[model samples]
Target: MNNVMGIALSGMRVAQQGVQVAAHNVANLATPDAQRLQLKRSAVEQGGVQASVTPAGVDAAAQLGDLLAAKAEVVAFAANATVIRRQDQMLGSLLDREA
Candidate 1:
């Protein structure tokens, strides 16, 4: 359904933002007084998900944990995308058969 696609797309965007935040943290590792950033997730009132970036402070261990979590998020995003693709393909096949 369209809602499913919207949710999956939002999830992908969150995962992408998380990956970007992790990369930024790694890039600024050597910079003095650098603040680590993280993506915060929330459900949309209309029935989807959304994310916002926030400062997480400067803790290396926490940042590492966040990076690992972000990797898992990326995996989840990939799985969702695959499901969406398969669903689209199945719908197309059904339409073709009907035609």
Candidate 2:
């Protein structure tokens, strides 16, 4: 329950970070000195995942692809959250029935 929610929340956080990085890359397209950034995610030792920002090159096609990927990540995060909500609801219903 808590573990599942934690994983979903971590995924949402990473997705948000990805979206921010993509938007930043798109916004700074014209800045010559700007260093394109990317969000990297890694699984934590305890559970969930964590995100980090790393330097990336400014390539138009790659940036576009990153935007699309971020969009997909958002959708995935939403789905994960939904699963957690549904699981929580089911647990509540079960507890109510038991009571």
Candidate 3:
């Protein structure tokens, strides 16, 4: 149960970082020689994922895709949050019954 929460929290954090990087790329679309950013993610050994920002090439189509992906990441973030909330509720109910 606790592990589930940790996994969900990590997922939410990754999604958030993804959105931030996407936003940065989209925001710099019009600037000259703006360094596009990309979010790289890797699974953690314990349980969860880690994200890092990296430089990327500038492409209009790719930037648009990133915006779309950012929208999806927002949804993913919300889903992870829901999982955490549900887990908390379940734990509370279990404790209540035990008490």
Candidate 4:
């Protein structure tokens, strides 16, 4: 196909973007409030972001969206966890005191 080089080059660019996005995610992984992000790509026909055969999952843009969703979940869990943990600890203390 005449578009092979174009495809190859496009794939490289997407891969580069993926690497950068992954690095960004790694940078924030340690942060409790931080989230990971990446874009999604596909070798789709008609204006598709050409990608290699690796299923082209989790590109930078998609990653951002995922990050937000994950953060929301984390926030929810953190809220519940904190309250539950504190309640459990307080209950334990009360029981110990009574005993």
Candidate 5:
């Protein structure tokens, strides 16, 4: 059951990360330097999955390291979903303006 718990925990953690990266992207939508932060995930060989966030233009690494620190993760959880949504709106607006 421990392994199952680990898997569950990992899944939750990864989902949270996804929401977080999106939030970051949204938060920076107005920032000229922001390039859409994206969250990357990799399956753990043994139990669960791991997640990391990087710029949209970055190449996907086949692996995820200890990139997200504990404090960062907490903040990410706080605003990730909202950030991503905002970013999406901003992107759409920019595209519409161009069109």
Candidate 6:
């Protein structure tokens, strides 16, 4: 149960980082020599995931793709949040039953 919560939280964090990277890339699209940013994600050894920001190409097409990917990440973040909310509700119900 706790593991599930941890995983969901990590997922949300990764999605957030992805969005931030995408936004940075899109925001600097018109700036000359502005290095694009990318999010590098990896699974944690114990559980969950991690993300890092890295430099990428300044292609307009790739930046658009990043925006689309950011949209997907928003959906992923919402789904993870839903999981956490449901888990909390279930735990509350369990406690209510015990009482």
Which candidate gets the maximum TM-score versus the true structure? Answer: 3
Give candidate 4 regions above 4 Å deviation. 46-99
Q: Kindly report the root-mean-square deviation of model 1 from the true structure over all alpha carbons.
A: 1.7
lDDT of 2 by residue, 6-95 (tens): 887887888788888888887877888988888878998868899999998657597668778778877977887897888799889999
Model 4 per-residue lDDT tens digits across residues 1-99: 324434444544665565555556656655766555545667657432543323234345654554564455345445545555566677789889999
Model 1: per-residue Cα lDDT at residue 4 = 75
| Winner by lDDT between candidate 4 and candidate 1 | 1
Q: What is the lDDT of candidate 2?
A: 0.83
Judged by TM-score relative to the true structure, which candidate is superior, 5 or 6?
Answer: 6
Q: Rank candidates by TM-score, best first.
A: 3, 6, 2, 1, 5, 4
Candidate 2 deviates by what RMSD? 1.6
The residue-by-residue lDDT of candidate 3 on 1-99, one tens digit each, is: 899999999999999999998888788788887898888899999898989999986565886798898999999999999999999999999999999
Each model's lDDT: 0.80, 0.83, 0.90, 0.53, 0.61, 0.90
Candidate 5 similarity to native, TM-score: 0.53
**Model 1, 30-91: lDDT tens per residue?**
88888888888899986668889998865649757766876887897898799689879988
For residue 13, model 4's alpha carbon misses the true position, in angstroms, by: 0.7
Error of 2 at 9 (Å): 0.9
The whole-model C-alpha lDDT of candidate 3 against the native structure comes to 0.90
Query: Model 5 Cα displacement at 42 (Å)?
Result: 0.7
Clashes of each: 0, 0, 0, 7, 5, 0
Off by over 4 Å in 5: 58-99
Model 3: residues with Cα > 4 Å off, grouped in runs: none
> What TM-score does each of the candidates earn?
0.85, 0.86, 0.93, 0.42, 0.53, 0.92
